[model samples]
Target: MTLLGPAEIRELAASLGVRPTKQLGQNFVHDPNTVRRIVRAAELTGDDVALEVGPGLGSLTLGLLEEAAKVCAVEIDPVLAKALPDTVRRFAPEHAGKLHVIEGDALRVDVDEQPTALVANLPYNVAVPVVLHLLATLPSLRKGLVMVQKEVADRLVAGPGSRVYGVPSVKLAWYATSKLAGKVPPSVFWPVPNVDSGLVAFTRREPPQEDRNEPSQEDRKATFAVVDAAFAQRRKTLRAALAGWAGGPDVAERILRAADVDPGARGEQLTVRDFTRIASQRQSQAPHG
Candidate 1:
C-alpha cells in the first residue's frame, strides 16, 4: 500500500479543487509516521473492522487498511467523499476491497454493520460530540484512538478536581476510560492547525453502578442535566450553581443533603456517581413523587 505524502496530498487536493476550510476543520494529515502511530495506538486485531471519520485525502484511511481487516470511512464533504473510493482503488488496489466510503456527517450517519473499532483524526470543531455520539450509538466499538485538539484531549482524560475536569470529563467517564497516548505536532498537516494535537486512547467500559442497579435512560438524562447545571457557573458552589436546576437555593440544599453531597462543594470536585446521586434525589423530590 502506498502511503500519502505531503506532495501527493497537495497534488490530490489541487486535482480535486479542494481547499482546506476552517469551517469544516479540514487539516489533512500528510505524515506517514503519524498515521502509523495512530493506527498502532488503536491496537487493531486481525479480525477488527475499523470505522474512520473524516478520511481526508485518504491519508490515515490507507494506514488503517494496512492493519485492519476492513475499513469503513465516513466523510461529510461530498467532494472528498466522492473522491476517496477511487483514491483507495488507485493507491492500494490490493486492499481496495477492504475499504467502504460513506458520504455523511459522522454524528448522524448510521452504519449498517457495526464496527469493532474506530480510528480517526476527527475534525477539531466537532471532535468531542462526535466521539460521544459514536460511542453512545455504536456499542460494538470496543476501543479506538482519536487525534483531537490538545485542550480537548486534556478534558477527556481529566480526573475529578482537575482544573480542566468538567462536563466532557464526567460524561466521557460514563462510557470509557481514556488517557493521553501521545502528541502530534502541527507541521505534519497540509494546512497546519494553530494548536497542537493529542492522541487519546480509550477502552469502553460499563458505566458506574454504585447502587447495584444500573441507571436507566431517563436516569442518565436527569443526571446529565444536573451535571450541566453544576458547571454552568464555575465560580459558584453546587448550592448556588444548582439553584436554577433545583428550583431555588433552599431546595438545592435539601436535594444535596438527600444525596449526601456537600452543597458548598464545587462541581469540579464531584464524580459521575455523585451526579447520579444528585439526579436521583431530584427525581424523588419531583411533584409527581
Candidate 2:
C-alpha cells in the first residue's frame, strides 16, 4: 500500500481545501516510516478489527488497513471521513473493502462491528477523554496503540506515586496496562506541531476490583468520584480533600481509616485500588436508601 508522504499530503490537503485546524488538533502525519512504526507497535492480528479515531487525511488509516482484518475509522470532519474510502481505493484498491468510515465524534460514535483493537493518532485536546470513553463504552477493545502529545502520553503510562500520575493515570489503570512505546518528532507532520508526540501501547485488563466480586459499573462510578475528589486539591491531604465527597473531614478520615488508608496521605500517593477501597468503605457506611 502506498502511504502518504509530505508532498502528497500537502497536495491532497490543498485539493480538499483543508488546512490543519488548531481547534480540532489536526496535525496530520506525513511520514510513511512513522505510520509503519505505529502499525508495528499496535501488534494487530489478521483477525483483529481496528477502530481508529480522528484518522485525519487517511495516513495512519492506510497503515492500519494493511494490518487489521478491517479498519473502522471515526473522523469528526465529514470531508475527511467521506474522502477516506476513496483515498484507500486509490492507494490500496485491494484493501478498499476493508475500510469503514464513520463521520462523527469518537466520544459518542457507535459501530456495528465489534472492534478488537484501537489504533489512531488521537487529537491532543481530547486524547485522554477519548481513550477513557472508548475503553468504558467498548468492552470489545482488547488492545490499542495511540499517538498523543508527549505530556499526555506520560500521564497515561504513569503509575501511582509518579509526579505526573493523577486522574488520567488512575482512570486508565482501571481499564488497561499502558506503556510508552516510542516517540515521534514534529518534523513528520504536515503542519509540524510545536511539540513532539509519543506512542502509547495498551492492553485491556480486568478492573482492579476484588476477585470475589465481579467488576461493577456502579463501583467504577463511585471509585472515580473518589479519585476526582482526592485530586481536586492536590496539595491537600485525603482527609481535607475528600471532606466534601465524604460529607465532612471527620467522616472522610473515618472512611479512610476503615479502608486501611492514611487520611494524611495525598491523592498522588494512592493507586486506583486504594481509591476503590475508600469508595467501598464509604458505600458500606452510607445509609441505605
Candidate 3:
C-alpha cells in the first residue's frame, strides 16, 4: 500500500469525489520510485522532523512519515484533504500522532518554526515562495527537499554565469546550498501536468552566511525593490533598472563604482555576492533617519 498505484488512485478519486483543483494546481505523485527517490534525497535520520506542503492524498506524505521523526503536512484541497486521514492512517499506523495536517493555502498560511527539515511535492505555483518563506523567514528550519517545476529547479541551483540565474538564484545562495537531485517525467502524476518536475534539496547553514541583516529583512521592500527593479528591465544595466531606487543616474554610477560592479552589466550577469554587495551598499548609503 506504499504507492496506492495509478489504478487505485483513479478508483479512490472516483469514490471520494476527488477532482484536482485547477486553481490550486493539485498534481499528486503516485510513482513509488519517485517518492522513494524523494525520500532518499532528503537524507533524513530518525531525529529529523519534516514538514510537507500540498500532501494530496498523502502519497509523498506516506514516504516521508516512514523516514522522519515528524511529518506535518499542509494541504489546501478539500477533496484531497478529505481522503488524507485514511491515507495517513494506512501508511503510518504506528506514528499517526506525528503526522499533523493543516488544511489551508500554503501561501497564505504563516510559516512556523516546528520541524527541523521541510519537504514537499509542491504545486508548481507555490514552490518558490513556500521554499523562500521557510528558508528566509523561518530560519530555524534546517533542510528542505522539494519537487518544483523543472525549470525553477534549474534556476534555484543555477550558478551566476548560467542563463537560468536570476533574483531567486541569488537569494537562494544567501542561505542554503541547493542541488538538483532528480528529474521526474510527467507520466508519474495522475492527470499529468503539462511540464515535468525536478527534485531539489537545500540544507540550511547554521549561521546562514547571509548578512543576517542584509537579505534577512524587516521588510524585503528594499531587497525585493532592488531585485524586482533589476529583473524589471533585465536586459538593461543594473544601474538603469535601479534608477528609481537610487534617485538619478549620477548617484547610481557612484553606487556601482562603490560596489565595483560593471555599470554595463544586467541583473542576469551578477552573482549573489554581487547583488548582496549592492544591497549592503545601498543600505549603507541611505540617509540616517
State which candidate has the highest lDDT.
2
Residue-level lDDT of model 1, residues 1-289, one tens digit each, is 7899999999999999999999999999999899888988999987999999999899999999988999999999999999998998889989998998999999898887689898999999999999989988888988989999999999999999999999999988888899999999999997988999999989999876546676666776888899899999989999999989988888999999999999999999999989988998888874322
Off by over 4 Å in 1: 286-289
Q: Candidate 2, which segments miss by more than 4 Å at Cα?
A: 287-289
- TM-score of candidate 1 against the unseen true structure: 0.96
The model with the greatest TM-score is 2
Could you tell me how far off, in angstroms, the CA of residue 262 lies in candidate 3 after the best superposition? 1.7
lDDT of 3 by residue, 88-204 (tens): 776667767777777788767765637888788888877888887777656668888899899999999998778888877866766778899989999999879999899888877
Tell me the lDDT of model 3 at 109.
71
Descending-lDDT candidate ranking: 2, 1, 3
In candidate 3, position 54 carries an lDDT of 89
The lDDT values for all models are 0.91, 0.92, 0.77
RMSD of each: 1.5, 1.2, 2.5
Each prediction's TM-score versus the true structure: 0.96, 0.98, 0.91
Write candidate 2's Cα lDDT for 1-289 as tens digits: 7999998898888888999999999999999999999999999999999999999899999998988999999999988888888889988999999998899999888877799999999989999999999999999999999999999999999988899999999999999999999999999997889999999999999998754888789999999999999989999999999999998889999999999999999999998999999999889895332
Model 3 per-residue lDDT at 145 = 86
